[model samples]
Target: MSVSFRLGILGAVGVLAAGLAHAGWLWFAWVAPAGALDPGSAAASSWMPLLVQGSWTFVLAAAVGWQLQRSGQPLQQSLALLRQQVQALEQGRFVVVEDPPAAEALPLARSLNAAVRRLQSAIEEAPGQGAQALRRTARRDAATGLDSRFTFIARLTERLADRGGAQTALLALRLLPVQPGLAPDPRALAAAAEMLHLFSRRVPGAFVGRLCESDLALCLPAHDLVAESAHSLIAALGSGPERLHCVVGCADHLGGVSLGGALAQLDLATAEAEAAGVGALVCRTSHREEATPQEEGALRRQIVEALRANAMELAAFPVVDAQGDLLHLECPMRLRLSPGQPLAPAQAWLPVAMRYRLTTQIELAGIEMALAASARDGLSRCVHVAAESLSAAGFVSAVRSRLQATPQAAALLWIEIAEVSLERLPPRLRNAGTVWQRCGARVGIEHAGAALLSLVRLSELELDYVKVASDFVRGVAEHAVQRERVQGLVAFVHEMGARVIAEGVDEQADLDALWALGFDGATGRLAGRQGTAEALVAPGSDAAACRDQAMSPA
Candidate 1:
């Protein structure tokens, strides 16, 4: 029987027992009176005893009810404690609640204790197999098993947390054809996971995780050999006709910090990799000298004020044709804290801005600046789009609207999306290329050649231009093989109906070599010195005046 029902029966029994005792007392009282006195007196005494006995029975029933009511309090308390413990567990905390010894509460207490034990066991076991499972889950592009995005973030996080004397490095392995033909089959993801698991086991003290659907992160904890490690890891993926590329970023002496801080640093390092255009990009987060509290505080304050006042500036570097005619301008956003202070690159403020969820505002402002510049007669503009902004449906729509409203300048505006960012685009915004194109705006992929695996597939996307990475063009004149390779790339792009622009052209020889290589345009330190907006607006006039003054006999 249920506990309540049993209690009810016990209470009823108690009442019955009291009633019986009361009846016995009445019988004794009545019998004694009858034997010792007259019939009338005995009858009256018997009636009085019966009345007293009935009153006692009522008192016993009340006592039983009171006892039952008091017992309910402990049950309520036990339930409340159970709820609190469950809440704690849900929040990823382990909790042990001591249950009362009452018989009614023992079952619930035992159940809770059992659950806590199981959870603790799971926690203890996670480092071994659990970590493996998480790696498998995140390793493959949810669709293709190439690599998932989460795997990258996790591996980078762990690497950043490592403090062993050995050097730590992060390698981002992105599969070519970042977007596989269709939704990746689960079977494919499983296969990819197995392959990666096997691959990871070969590397000692290495942890692999997913950073996104298409990015896999590999962390090597005890290696001073970043370059060798990257080459080995890539080689293990096997020699194939198709390129299997890995972008690596490494740091030595990465110390302990909050997870958020580590992620922030990882994001910066990744950006550096993308910008650097290496087959593998490696960065050391630990500097020879640490930033003092005062310095960090000042930087933080300056960034805050810049964000608050929307005072950041966007600067444009011209991408000129072989004959030195401006084909378009590569507009990289720069931030200036105050007059006379040097401007900082987007990487400097971008991470914190993202942490603060201010990417959209910053991107929008950049778009405005680019459009304004393009609207000036005889100028074309290419501006970068952050992956996060592109992932948002609303932001895409807003950008489309803005482009449409500026149709006269839209064709001149080339929206450049990085390969990494492109991989993260949601389905709703996957057709962003089509959307932007329909609005009379052109699109291009920046940091090209870095992710050679994705190059051919992305090429098939039919972008308007491809900005060959600066690193690839660093010393094109000095290396025959590099020059021929660049020439071949320019030819291939031209055949695809897309223009090729070489970035990071810092030397006169690099610019001259690019011209001979059939590159349609070039942009970098060597193209021309960067100047203020007003100076750029009158490039011809400004240069003529300077030349005239310099040539004047002195």
Candidate 2:
């Protein structure tokens, strides 16, 4: 109990003992002796001794009890301090007591401090771990480990967004022997996934995914031997015990074709394959007359020569902050094969570059060009690095050495990897981002939000900023739901300790809405341009109209 109460109890016990001793002495030495002898002698001799012994005994016991209680006070105080620290920890405050009141609690305090440190470390690594888990559970088929339909579609759309769909080849496969209205057999699906996974290994940079209940698809660089891969896939399907039949259709992404248009072409090819019969394969070329082998070789040689000659120019665009101040210049490479030929945007030639395995070399060259321009212009510039290049061997080291060589230019550089690619190489990106940052450059993800859950782990990538894809930002000005999403995304990115930027701000109204929603910066036709005299949410504008419509339901 308390020191005061314990001491009081001890004092009472001492007083009782002292009283008992006094009573005994009185009976034997005072009362009994006085009755048999002279009263005055007995009283005079016993009274003084009795008073001295009782007083000394009571005082001595009380003094010793008080000392013991005082000695325990430090320990009691130390326990209270520990309790406070533990409460703080429970409340998410990692406070520790320095110099605990008593040495008895020193070891416990050290242990508590160590626990706090460990928890902090786990929290720091949690985002990346959580991101990976999300990709597995949310983005992939549970059994197949292939991207979910929605995730696959998003990635396809992103890839196709580039010019000529980056010359991608779409291979669609339909498993046969399906009962009408019934789902495809899981065994067949799993077997198909396994076959596709193995076949993909033979095709570099090939991506496979389950697109429908009985249909699966793979996309790769168009220059790959699509017909041969399809044949191999069909043969593998027939080798199984069930002799499962499959129809394979291959379509090359043609320039100027929309995603829907490309899918339509793929569907036509699949229909043709099915009509040809089960286990049949059909191929659709981009042109009515496919290029000959010599023509293909000539184009490849030209690209190689162009790369060797370093015949590309960079087109810089401004990404600006909320106040319309320039944040950086996005310098995308524009290839010019000959002095007479006009510059071609990356979309026009990237597919060819990818086909020739020249992306790594081309991207590296672009980085060098951007850095040189940054040095000369003294302006901050951003360069987009494709996922292919990032995974290419020696790419990171080459960029690191180049950045190190031009420290000043590196400091002014911003390197971005696509969001779709980010999902594929977080660990590599994590290391690369740190190296780039240390070399005075910043790394980030562009075209983000394809996989919403993956954004939660942005901190794991250690990026400087995240650029939200235009699809999400397109009509946020007129859609209340979109505005809410953008706002939440901005807050989430901020919590992850990275700025959020809006890409493809085509309309002034959209840009205004983004600015109000707390976007840190943005790029597009409308960004970096002066705002109109009217308020951001002007009357009769889409933003105001949307607000009114949302409140109308009330």
Candidate 3:
């Protein structure tokens, strides 16, 4: 294969041929034109034969040169083609060589194509084999081996976009934590995660997402969602009404929705199932419901008018410690459309406010209401500000001005923003925190579960505490998985210099569990009843009785 060796073999063969030609010419006396000695000549005239021999030799040499040039054209062409194929391989393309390689390279081309096919197949089969595809992170959930929430959602969005208005079914399975108030065995959580994961693999192209700590969503074509698959999933995830179990809610969409609306539908369906009871499964086959543009505009108009007219009403709820001591009153301000109109709760209109980017005004209104009330009664308050508000132009300056106007309220105010909102624009959040500090007010993140996965990231924010989402705290006393997750979170957050406030601790058992687990404080109706803090809350003390009513539909 070496060039030197090839040249040596050719040289040896050339020498042998030349020696044989000389021997035959001399032995037969081929110097004469007749190719034999002339019997009648004393000394042969070598010149006469030399002329004839030279002419013939010239013709033979010319013919050989033409033959070699023709042969080399094929070699050059094949080599160029081989180089092109190699470059394509280097670039990670597995294209079939449309023009077969020359006979010499054909075997190599075949072998390379075979290797590429094998790698391509491996990439499709193993998520970790993404090197061929050059995708980062293996496009999966590291813990459960399911699709990560972002990946699942993105893939689902692509499918919906491709087949718009197509019938699609989504399963939102909210797993209730079991063996509450104890550290969950990681093996147990893994088993459950894998159970759902395997179920998702029943049909090819199944899309699954880890929506939150306890929520997993599976999206597939409507036709693939049959009773048999449902039964198998329930069996694997633990099906029973009397025991703690994961309840699945199914929502069917009719090509009439975007990804957001479809997800919202699943949420509503899940809520329906939760209300129904254990072993409950709710299915909705309705067309996706969406607010008309006109309706949305009208809602925005109402919120704007209310903000302009100072029509915000405070609904005070108590956040208490384990000792039933109220740390502070969370005054979630609500909006009223016109004079005498009942106030709309945060849930009812916050979504609308967020949608229209009206959160800046809403946050300002909440702070102003809380400040006014605190100044009037000397009560410490925790007021909510929308995360979107921080992005508003001049929002930090506005907060500073509000605080400066009632500097005394600063000491009594705690501004709460949803963790989901705080997650974006770290610089902006840091700036807001700086403003809060300058104003002598405190800020904390609320609804921590949806936006955060680990506690270490909390150090990035300038927050005093994080309110673990109510879903994590609601049944902590009986849910082992929830307890372990919250426990780790609390420990990590403490190390990060922030307290862990468990939200929605209405049950005595839940409260007791959270306290034992080192939760700094908590909030809910139960906490409110036992609160010892002497803070003056809403204008009417009867707001305590309206805790349930305040949260109800307007």
Candidate 4:
């Protein structure tokens, strides 16, 4: 029976017992003597039994009420404890509780504790998963699923550093027209990415990475020869349907060489590829002498100091239209001096800076120089960004902050990321582009008519202009097919709400051809040889007065 019913029954039983006892006592009194039935004695005898039974019933009710209150206390306490445990688990803390009430709360505590254990185990596994995710993130271009700049550099450096104990080589593929202006199609970029993926799969141990939007690096390990490996890679890339015409540079370590030396060799190979208009070119550098530990240490120190002091020189090339009107200047960076002497192209110092993880610093210096130059000249300027630097989340903020500090210079500042860098434009960069546009600055794409037609995707960026590769524009005059192709490209770019600038124009015919082809502007030897800021402007302009009078002649 329920507790209330049981208590009622017990109460009834107690009353019955008391009644029986009282009856017995009365019977005894009657049987005793007539004197026992006296008035005072009878009164006491009748009231005593009844009062005792009432007191017993009241005591039983009080005991039952107390027991009920005590039972509820355990339930309430258990619930409070469970809430606390769940809160702890949500906060990622897993600790065991002791001495829980065995009967009512033990099962709950065990279940909760088990859940906590599972949570702890999952939490423990998270770091490993996170680490793997970071590695994957580092290896692929964030935007296009192509290899990242860092992974590519590391693989190239490793291959170059490995002395020919086993044949090691690097294929540096530079998409022609590194500068902005050729409106690239997004489909071309995807096609290039697919082609690279296919090529990598065909060549064993060949790791492909996007060094920049305009460059791709492939490292071939265990190759029988460096030249052969480069050729094979080029052939594979050329055979692709996309027909990405790449300037391939190949380099190998003939003997023990520092990672820096290996990169230098790769740089040389890239130059060779640029010189040759083929799908690929290979240059092998045999280490002449083994670098001593002291030499390596000294080189490292030099690099550190150079990067810290921003000891680099910046040169600006004027971007002029077909009318010979100066529109903007493109700043390409060059290292002033290294441990040995001035490094030639960025390729020489860049790999080392990247290997030592100093690209961010270098990028900062480049931006600072470009901004300062823009401020002084009061002309719009375009600064190049490495693919790897673009991947860094803070890079945009750094550039924006620097630009903000120079209010007068912000409007004229234009930042151009290589086509390859676009493969991994971080969200921060994409957002930064909007911020930059709002600040009266424009964003442009460099090396437009090269591999990875997917550059068309950039149309969504609403960029100010697209610069086509000079080579594509150079001989258009001689080839009607080429001229028509460029015309169509310019038309497509215009449709995207962006203008086109042609590069590498060295002849009036070339300029005339581009003008006819509908290019917005042109730059190269024909536009004007590299000259001072003054020479870039019209004769009466302030910049023109600063031109070296002796060089210009009256």
The lDDT for every candidate, in the order shown, is 0.56, 0.66, 0.61, 0.58
Q: Give a tens-digit lDDT track for model 3, residues 458-531.
A: 45455687877565466678755445545545665665567789766657898888898888887765666665
TM-score to native of every candidate shown = 0.46, 0.49, 0.55, 0.48
Model 1 CA lDDT for position 461: 66
Off by over 4 Å in 2: 1-291, 531-554
Name model 1 segments beyond 4 Å from true.
1-305, 336-343, 376-378, 426-428, 529-554
lDDT of 2 by residue, 111-159 (tens): 6665554444443443333223322333566768887654675667666
Count clashes in each candidate, considering only residues at least 3 apart in sequence or on different chains: 20, 0, 7, 34
Best by TM-score: 3
Ranking by TM-score: 3, 2, 4, 1
Q: By TM-score, how accurate is candidate 1?
A: 0.46
Q: Give the poorly placed runs of model 3, Cα more than 4 Å off.
A: 1-170, 173-247, 250-280, 283-288, 426-429, 449-454, 460-462, 479-482, 533-554
What is the number of residue pairs that collide in model 3? 7
Q: Tell me how far the alpha carbon of residue 211 in candidate 4 is from the true structure, in angstroms, after superposition.
A: 22
Error of 3 at 450 (Å): 5.5
**C-alpha positional error of residue 24 in candidate 1 after TM-score superposition, expressed in Å:** 55
Off by over 4 Å in 4: 1-298, 338-344, 426-428, 506-508, 530-554
Residue 188's lDDT in candidate 4? 55
